[model samples]
Target: MRGLSWQIGLRYSMDRSGNQLVSFLSRLSMLGLILGVALLVVVLSVMNGFDQEMRSRILSLVPHITFQPWQQDRGDWQTLKAEVEQHPSVTAAAPFLQGNVMLIKGNAVEPSLLLGIDAAAERKVSRVGDFVDLGLLEGNREGLVLGDALAKKLGVEVGENISLGIPQSSDSNDVRFAKLPVLATVATGTELDQQLLLSSLETAARLLPSGQTLSLRVSIDDVFNAPRVAWELASVHGQDYIIRDWSQQFGNMYHAIQMSRKLVVIMLLAVVAVAIFNVVSTLVMVVNDKSADIAILRSQGASQGDILRIFLVYGAVIAGVGALAGGVLGVLLALGIGDIVAAIENALDMKLLQSDVYPINYLPSALRWGDIASVCGTAYVMSLVATLYPAWRASRMPPAEALRHG
Candidate 1:
């Protein structure tokens, strides 16, 4: 009987001799589901890619944790660095001098975060060496490395001298000026490109007052664990230092990404649900059109349960085929969306993402099987549930009335 029900259901599903409108609606429902699922997959994959870029590009260069003196007594930076390196979560540690300064070239002036670093030790703590020309800073205390965007804004180039306006004291209006030749430029494809100035520790010390203490910057294996590790390190030193973590600096951006991802999922899932529920309308039309056939089957000893099962099977076949096909199409699109967008950008001769505004100016994608499974499963289940009402209506129809109406 089960086999017989399957055969009948499949035959009805495949039959195109019936009303043309019914067949068209069925196909349209399938098409909508395919489009909705494919779009969801692609968008989520792109969001995942952005998350990856944020972690890799921004977090890699920004210190995961930093420690600066809160008291007047400057502690031994080498001892602190060595102690930080001994932590299990800590990967590398380096000493740095950070201060804000204004860059002046001719008539152009721009504000920048001046970071003084040891070229050799900085490489161990961050990927700054990969983006910076380390050779230019080596043994060149009077040289400076500007972020590409800052350099462009100042109309300065490599080998051009730029004046640094450093504040003499935090409380006073006094400003000390010094000139240094631009050694190189760093292009990090992030906002850092607009505001960073790199120089050797000796050069930065010369620009500032005599008694500024060096701070420790530490990188860890797990970025998310930075806050906990930072506090633990602070506790060991009896709270004499100020502890800062990456989250305090960039937490808002990370939260924004997560919030955007959740909103996108909710909106896209609603679209998919609407597409799947269109099957309800399609099945209702099928039930009305097949009343005469349904009456004949009932008169031939087909039980109400059998009638219900037939329509359920029919709906299942439609939902199953549509969901499977959509899943396959979505997976394919998600895997290649990056290249597709890149090709489109090239052909159009325009940028979708600007380096000055956005982090990493390119579309990226990272397909996850978990997301694929969730989307397809939700679609299929919604589609299957949508068939219940029409199937029940078909089962409850009286054979005598149906035949009389036929």
Candidate 2:
């Protein structure tokens, strides 16, 4: 009967008292399968999390697209901003002036790039301002906002006066100097904290040399198609304007995430392959241990097809149980990874991801059903393949020879 094939295969895999080695091998194979699948799922989910953070946090802080005059300062920024938002793809636009300057707080002088922004308009295109508790440039003319790390380097605090020096190429070599107080110190937990200096556009107008060009920051509805959208905007704005996008500003990070994800998946798949290959060894030992029993079944009119089906079922059970357990475990781990990281951090009193080296200093993870399905499918296919050689050998065994040897 069909049920007899299933019964014999199941008994062979589970009969520990008769042959300890076969039972041990079966358990080892299942354990390997479980570990391999679980690891692949967790690693893939973490990569997915990183990709999401790249799009959400990093992309939100930077401009999806930027447009600037190739010739000189675009004094009519108000007009340009309005024109940019008219496009269906363009969601928001803001004006910004940026230049290099030296910051001086007593003897602690640091080189910095100062960004002059319209407080109200800048908020439309970027959430960098929201990361901080205080408005570093709000209502404070001739005041500066220092990034947390920059503030630490300067050894200064809010309401402290800092001097800014700009290079002035006059008839004689003279640098223009202006003094402004620190409006606020902000910790964005991004690379922006390293060398950012924020000031109101009006303050920058007085502090920097005359004729500094302003660049337009633009946000788009479709982030992935930013380059194409930016090019379209540039075409309408005229050829004299140059455009840049987040892809250029933060592409290395995005590309690294993608490349790492591909490489890791490949490596883990190999691990899964190795684990799956162990199924062959497991089935071989099971067939050997059950040779006499197999011969008995043959003598009792069991067909070769029945013998093959039995072993196949045995291997499938190992693979199916292992895969199901692993998939469940991996999803649970990935979803609760943030809490795990927090617990570890609290116990060790140390930070895992440093903000200076990474985009954000927190653990992020996401689990997708598609990834789990792939892991399970790969396991099932490999397990089925591993059973073929052993199952075939058992099916072709001569009942007389197997009986004589027994």
Candidate 3:
């Protein structure tokens, strides 16, 4: 009975002779499901890629945690750095001095965060050392390492001198200015390229009133655990110090990305659900058109359960084929989307992502099998559920009444 039902259901699904409208609607419903599932997969993969790129590019260069004195006077930074490094979660610690200042070159002026770092020590905590030769700032008190974007904006190049204007006090407008030569330029492919200025720890100390005591920048094994470790360090060895982490600086952006990803999932899932539900209309049309055939089958001793199973199989065939095709299309697109975007950018001779405005000037994609599986599975299940009402209606229709109507 099951084999007979399956064979008849498949034949009916393939037959387009009786009603052209029903066949067309069935194909349209399957097409909608395919498109919805494919788009969802591609979008989710891109979101995953963006999240990964942010962690690797921005978070890798920024300090995971920072410890600074609460008072204006510099504290014992060496002892603090050593203590931070002793923690099990801490990977490396480096000393740095930072100040908010303005850069001047000719008529152009830009605000920037002036960071002073010990080149060798910085290499342990940051990947900035890989981009620029921090060693150049060692003995050259007037040397600076500017982000490529900042240098371009200032119309300055390596060996060109730019003036650094540091405010004497937060309350007063008195500013101390010094001329420093650009030693090198670093391209980090992030927003840092717009407003970061790098110098030696000694030079940074000279620019600010805090002479010798520097703040410790710590890197940890797991970036997500930075807040807990920072608080622990603060409570134990930082009674006179303040604790800060990368989350304080970039948490909002990270959270925004996560929120957008979730919102996109919900919106796209609704689209998929709508497409799946379209199958209900298609199946209802099929049930009405096949009423006489169903009546004949019942007269031949086919049970109501057999009739229901036949339509269920018909719906499953449509959904299963669409899901499989969509998965294949989605996987191929996700795998090649990066190259496709790059080619489009090349042909258009334009940049979709500017490094100064966006992190890493390229569209990225990272396909996960789990996402594919979940999307396909959910779509198939929804499609099957949509078939239930129409299938039940067909199964319960009295054969005598159906034949009389036929």
What is the lDDT, from 0 to 100, of the residue 31 in candidate 2? 90
Model 2: which residue pairs collide? none
> For model 1, what is the C-alpha lDDT against the true structure?
0.86
- Highest-scoring model, TM-score: 1
For each of the candidates, the C-alpha root-mean-square deviation to the true structure, in angstroms, is: 2.3, 2.6, 2.4
Model 3 accuracy (lDDT, Cα): 0.87
Provide TM-scores for the models.
0.92, 0.91, 0.91
lDDT of 1 by residue, 82-199 (tens): 8888899999888888888888989998887788888888887788788976766667468899889889999999898999999887899999999999999998877788887989
Per-residue lDDT of candidate 3, residues 1-406 (tens digit): 8899999889888888879999999999999989889989999999898898778878999999988888767588888877778899999999888888999999999999899998888998988987887779777456899999889999999988899899878888889999988999998878788877989987888887544358888999999898898889878967788889999998888898889999999999998888888888899889988999999999999999999989998999888987888888888998899999999999999988887666676777889899899999988888888888988999999999888876
Best by lDDT: 3
Candidate 3 — which residues are off by over 4 angstroms? 138-142, 210-212, 343-361, 404-406
- Give the C-alpha miss distance for residue 255 in model 2, angstroms: 1.7
Off by over 4 Å in 1: 71-73, 343-350, 355-360
Per-residue lDDT of 85-163 in model 2, one digit per residue for the tens?
A: 8999888888888777899888899999888888888888888767753355666567888888889888999888888
User: What ranking emerges by TM-score with the best candidate at the front?
Assistant: 1, 3, 2
